[model samples]
Target: MKTAEEKKTRNTKHQKAVLELLKNATKALTADEIREKLADNINKTTVYRMLDRFVEAGKIHFVTGQNGKSFYALCKSCKEEPPKHIHNHLHFQCEICGKVECLPETLKVPQLDNYTIRETQLLLIGTCKRCMNSTN
Candidate 1:
């Protein structure tokens, strides 16, 4: 017997919580990780739907892990008002801990003779500093 407005409001609350979680995350998180961190214990379907909505809104982006798992992270280059998605930096994945993070350094796209480059996805895989330091 819940009204449409009530359902929409609930969805909005969940969306906000997801956004806040991603905003505070240092590394990209998987859907399972996100679900575990949420206080409300949202269902898997609802969590995925929320993530899809955020991706469509351009408020966040996904990086594919080595095992084909997708990790979601906040869009640092996206504008708040219009939510334009612009990714110029590369993604780094730590082999030891399996954490993915966006690198702050932008790539210097090299010019080709004639080919036009519309987009690029560069993922660097190696042991992250935290793992390297821990092993030493």
Candidate 2:
């Protein structure tokens, strides 16, 4: 357990980063992006540790990438966005570009009725439009 000051500091830092990245991000980004943006000020270990808290706090979501590392993004704000979150939007992972995007208007993830739903994540692997068009 951390002290109150520590917890507060952690919350402020993580929340700021989460919102900053989410608002600017087109899709999900890996820890590498975070480190790149913040540099030495944001240690990789700190990012991972803070990510855990953000996930638990329902501020962020995670998905597995082709590289096997867990990619993360800002959680769909249950308030402004549709409740169909968790796994609502289908993911589009670019093969050549190696970018993961949340296809909001695309994949319609089924919402299971019954029982409590805790977390949801989806992965759609394919070549992105940019990559596909480039191939042709």
- Estimate every model's Cα lDDT from 0 to 1: 0.84, 0.71
lDDT per residue (tens digit) for residues 1-136 in model 1: 9899998998888889999999999999999999999988788899999898887777887878898988999987655333323466889999999999999888776768887654457788999999999999
TM-score of 2: 0.73
- What TM-score does prediction 1 earn? 0.83
The local distance difference test score of model 1 is: 0.84
lDDT digits (tens) for residues 1-136 of candidate 2? 8999997887687768656876688878888787777623666787787788777766677788888978777756444322333455567688799898776654444556886555556787888888888899
Reference-based lDDT, residue 101, model 2: 75
Q: RMSD in angstroms, all models?
A: 3.1, 4.0
Any residue pairs clashing in model 2, and if so which? none
Best by TM-score: 1
